[model samples]
Target: MAEPRFSRFAAIDWSGAQGHRHKGIAVAVCATGDAAPTLVAPPGASAWSRDDVLDWLLCQDTSTLIGLDLSPAFPFVDQDGYFPGAPDSPLDARALWKMVDDASAADPHLAVSSLLTDPEIRRHFRQHRDCGDLFPGGAGRMRVCEHGQRTMGLSPTSCFNLVGAAQVGKSSLTGMRVLHRLAGRLPVWPFDPLPPHGPAIVEIYTTIAARAAGIRKGLSKMRDAVSLDTALANLGSQPHRPLARYDDHATDAILTAAWLRANADRAELWRPQAMTPHIARTEGWTFGVS
Candidate 1:
């Protein structure tokens, strides 16, 4: 008998502060390389102590390809609110909710549908009701473990901005709508009804590409949207009238590019890897990407 081949897949819906984090992260680890992912936990209890969470994360099969909903980078701001750097925001749920509401009002087609109905969505906002925790202050506690680098959290505004634009939209939508939102644009709108920012078209593109790649189910209608032939043709490149800038859309495209690059057999090719750091181990954490 031969040993079975397997692949470990995981994703996190990151949150900080008391009660703001999801109940449990949506984790899917499988012993079969091609097996469909399964939910490891609900949206509650997802927040474990740092050590325990790290232990669980590191304990996963070494072949795992972990996708974190948290931003790995932040945005750069020069002037005119046109932040050019990576995106981030403070961990304040109220502020985030307000942003979501404002952004949703800017465009009707931009909200993630699941967020509108998901009970947990409101839970996230309600958790931060009274505390006066400020932004840029709690970043240190919301650190992201990227490429083995240990650092404080990226600016939540940057993450929201990057995702709200186009470069970092996939992660944001995933966090906002749960994985279901990434199912692709079709009968369902990708933006949350009360989205923190304007609709992210690039996220739409990424969702289409993800559906084409078979990462999501029940999106047969989106097949044509993410086809490689369509991507190569670049036809219908222009989407509906814009309420936001290209950078927002570009953020989604960039995330789609990452997903496609990571799983070319599934989606269309958009951008190539420009740079990837070799993560070094710190504090007993051996982190690095091949």
Candidate 2:
């Protein structure tokens, strides 16, 4: 049997202070037949800026596809073709929609009129039906749920999931698929071997858990909230609200944990490290990610 083309692949989970600065930009790379993936940090004392991150990412000579969990671009189809999400100041959900409009006009092939109603798109979107309401243009809208309807301020089940809904879930789905694809391409630059399957899962778990544990510790340190209610109050006036945003530190850590737990392999290798200046310098990875 032919070996899978990809042996070395990397999975990165990036986040802010709510997450671990040490593991803020978690990276895991593995190679075929290797006992475990060599988890390395970039050598530096500087934190990663948006541009720096992209520069570093584009600079990676790994030749292997790099899977980034961040929004590389918005995956939406307006009247036209596809549009990539831009990293711009005042970046928000609204800007994303506008770009979709622009992409549609610039390229005729890019229009998404048919894709929205396509059976495959509809089926794939159903997995996240709870969050969005897809409206077939001129065809009226199908209410998916009350919460979605209220959130989009559209008639129940009449709004499109492509817009205000399913952001996190959709991004996650995209990330996982990218990871799988990158894993198929063998390592190219500064190639390192991957640990056994068991250890790999362990490392992934530890990294994610470490981030979660850090968040719990920080909340404790600030005395933000000993209880859920107190924490919510400390954060704002909202009742029963989470201290952290769904896309904030907690979400990333939780998602990372979920990913690790799901991909557990008995033969993988696991290892983690603290962010020490010497270690950071030696590893050639940034110490502080701004």
List, residue by residue over 1-290, the lDDT tens digit for candidate 1: 54322134343333321233333233323322322233344323533432233345534434443444433322212121211121433232223434444434432233333332334332222122321122232221211232213221112232322212223333443333322222232111112221222211111223433343444333322223234223322321222222122222222332333342234222111121322121111001111211
Off by over 4 Å in 1: 1-6, 16-21, 42-52, 76-273, 276-290
Compute the lDDT of residue 288 as modeled in candidate 2: 12
**Alpha-carbon TM-score of each model against the true structure:** 0.31, 0.30
- Specify the highest-lDDT model's number: 2
For every model in order, what is the number of clashing pairs?
44, 43
